[model samples]
Target: MGETIDAGGVDLWVERRGTGPDVLLVAGLGDTAEAWQAQLDGLADRYRLTAFDNRGAGRTPLSEEPLSVPRMAEDAAALLDALGIPAAHVAGFSGGSFIAQELALGRPELVSSLVLVSTCARPDAYFRSMTGFWHWMAERAPSERAMLEAFFLWVYTPRAHADGTVARIVEETLAFPHPQSVDAFQRQLASFVRHDTLDRLAQITAPTLVLAGELDLATPPRLGRVVAEGIPDAEFEVLPGEAHQPFQEVPDLFNARADAFWREVGARG
Candidate 1:
């Protein structure tokens, strides 16, 4: 079990389990800490796993004002400060990766290593296409079921669609019982759309592992490659037949590879 703590000005939700080197998990846009359940379950036995909901999402208190990506990174750093964690291996997915990059740049002392998943180093014209799709969703105001189906196609691989993970995610989202706040959702979308980290990446010194999904239409392999290449000594990998959410689509492989990267990076420390 875990508890909520006052992080930055928000009531940040934090959870910890297992024992070993600390590993922090950051979720993607519109996702909660629970989205990392697969990673926590798989690596808990061998790592001190920490996962928290970003401000304005999940159980965490909403941001008073819409936050920029750098501010979100600061919120993450504040959460670590509240927990008295000096440093830890940090992992982030999608836009969360942008936050991780900022943490490494702004608070390097608190970051041991980095695992950036399904993210770009900088916002490019490709992000416009993805944001346009989200705007389309906003305009449609489809039923939850319909929204879930569209998002599933956008985030998961064809294999996951065939195996029913998409339906399972939809069911989980629907069962959560909370009404979706369209305003909050739009704010999260705008944050990513406005985030551009192209020049900041070269300043990141954290040993990095950039993961991508071959079949991902959003944040495609090229984004991962460019990001990895930007950081000195960064490694990159692509999960075959996977989409935007590789950890969800290929949990076993994703966990093993990510865990290994963390281990190797931590060993250097």
Candidate 2:
């Protein structure tokens, strides 16, 4: 069953599963807790998993105030506090990875280990342009199909496209019940453009694993490398033949790597 936690001013919709050391899963922009279904299905048996919809996504209601990465990080921290969790292994995907970085930097004691997947440390001009296009599509796309088509073009590789994997994902995305609204999507895009953690990464003392897809264009491997280099002693790995959503594209490989990392961290504690 799902629960609604009063995270400061926002009511966050959260799901908890399995029974072990806590592992918090944070999704990307316009994504809900449902985005982590693969991870929950694959890793929940081994570790206690907590997935939540961000303020503007899923059943979480958005406020009129602007959304920022730091605020989202606070919401994550607040959720944990509400549940009486001292700390947990934190894993974040894409824009959610940005929130994980901020959480570690701001509340180091609340993070046991950090996993950043398909994420970037800062938004460059190219990143800005990409998000700008997404924002435009969110507002002006003639239909959901057109928006999905445009998103798939940048999020998946030629291999996924050839194998019909992208098509399946697009269909699932369209059928999702709690899709993000255009205004919420635009807010997320603006927040992404404003996110920059290059100077603050060193403040995060938690052990971090930086995973990137070799074929990802949105946030390329080079960007992941920068993130790893910025965080002291962070490990970086590139998944072969994967795109932006490596966790979904290669579930077995992604789950194995993530499970190993979490287990190692849990053992240390």
Q: What is the C-alpha lDDT of each candidate?
A: 0.83, 0.89
Which pairs clash (backbone N, Cα, C closer than 3 Å) in model 2?
none
* Model 1 steric clash total: 0
Residue 45 C-alpha lDDT in model 1: 93
Candidate 2 local lDDT, 32-122, one digit each (tens): 8887888888888888999999988989998888789999999999999988899999999899999999999888999999999999989
What's the CA RMSD of model 2 in angstroms? Answer: 1.1
Model 1 lDDT tens row, 1-269:
76898877678888888898888888768788788888889999989888987776778766577678888899889988988888999999998888888889999999999999998976678788778677668558568678778877778887778888778888899897543466666777788788777776888888999999898888999999999988988999888778898787678999999888887876777
Q: Best-fitting candidate, measured by TM-score?
A: 2
